[model samples]
Target: MNGNDQVSRCGYVAIVGRPNVGKSTLLNRILGQKISITSKKPQTTRHQVLGIHTEGATQAIYVDTPGIHLAQGDRNKAINRYMNDAATSALRDVDLVVFIVDRTKWTEEDELVFQRIEHLKVPVILALNKVDWLDDKAELLPFIQKLAARRDFAEVIPISAIQGDQVSVLEQAVAQRLPESIHYFPDDQVTDRSQRFLAAELVREKIMRSLGNELPYQTTVEIEQFKYQGKTLHIHALILVEREGQKKIIIGEKGERIRQIGRDARVDMQDAFESKVMLNLWVKVKRGWSDDDRALKSLGFDDLG
Candidate 1:
């Protein structure tokens, strides 16, 4: 075949791992833009985000999935179930799977992900993430050896998703394995998510990072209205909590807490949208909506699955 006719390589790639394993971070690094919202908190990404990368004729459609973890007690809520379902669903009918894990630590959740991928026929690449945090680089050899014994990975790559280390190598690895086909999306399009969805996610991310440990999981943001007027976007959002007390906590003593959340979210939204944002936020109590399937479906959680 001619060089121009032979360069085409396009396929689906799913990035899966336990919560806080830097799956979203790696996606942002690969695409070189923040389409998926991220926080230090586990389960920060509750939806399936599609990021597309094109180089020459290689077009890789990357699916950034929610971290899969063992669900129990309050963790057995519908939201968590949705996340697990979303992550698992991404694995089906994909040309490649990049299973991400931390540099030096492997938890039970990691094993859970391993079990899920064990039966998949697609090629699985084990990515040892967070190598930048390692104090002794020697530790990685044994870790890679140990993980390699668990499964027959197509390739094992060490990367620092935050530092952008070896990420291009990982991309090359992914691209080389993709089956040749036509580009699934336009070359310039970076992600499958729209600005409106990303705006809501940015708001949720601000709430997650701003509030202390407990509040993040108890909160979810819903975009009530998103409209563009001239050079500015007018956005109205609702911060949903399970109880009146939780709503009070989000609102803070003199509404300062919610104001800060709005401010932070607005700045990020402006950066993402590339325009001024007029954000209107309100705190509302939905009372156990997280555990209710119907409630979660209404809140747009079920669509991820």
Candidate 2:
């Protein structure tokens, strides 16, 4: 049938998993673009990123969420609560849920995610991510069978989000389940986020990748200026940390580390914006911002439930 004669299908699909389970990678692979940032650290994704994929008559809007983790004692910060809420809230009305798990390893966090979605009326596809990293291919079927017995999943598919193995099959499975409806985004559109948000995210991604375990979680990026002059995109990002020590760590000796971060971020911005980028970065101390509710709200963390 011609394009005009076929019916369009569109729906929201939520990708949920524990920290560092390749949820962002899967979304980027499915959409063939990067909307969600990734790092080796847990909780790298702290917000709900929407990636839109339109193919022929099917458009799947994917919500890539933060890793749902337990918070207690020192970990029970306002930001942690925000992250958990953001992750769970994405499940409210989604048409389908792609529950990703690290290959053959189910932790308490994975069980927590399952508990949250167990009662949902929508179809849940259990995606076994990182299958390419598995040493023994013989373990696949038994692991699949073990998880499949947890509940009645619509489909239990093994996929390697990083290697693009079975990713197309996963996308096809998602497309088949989408409801018949008009596309919410244009065929050319890929994400619901703006360039300003993406610019800040790219900077944050660099920080996450550059720093050690603890510091990246203590930092966030804010764009002070984003404008176009001639053929260049100029951006000024403010990196906020909770202490002077943290600021110094990000800045590094003789400002070399921060400069490297800027250089990396600028390249990504240029590629994403398709324009020359004049990027500037600065680090500041915002004490207790990560734990203070008012500070978090002021820093644009108030969108979650």
Best by lDDT: 2
lDDT of 1 at 216: 40
Candidate 1 clashing pairs?
A: none
Against the true structure, candidate 2 reaches a TM-score of: 0.97
Could you give candidate 2's per-residue lDDT for residues 31-53 as a string of tens digits?
77788998888999999999999
Candidate 1 has a TM-score of 0.96
Q: Which digits, one per residue and each the tens of the lDDT, describe model 1 over residues 21-112?
A: 99999999988888998889899999999999988889999999999999998789888899999999998889999999998798999999
- Position 275, candidate 2: lDDT: 97
Q: When superposed on Cα atoms, how far off is each prediction in RMSD?
A: 1.5, 1.3
List ranges where model 2 is wrong by over 4 Å.
Answer: 1-4, 214-216
Specify the poorest-scoring 10-residue window by lDDT in model 1. 1-10
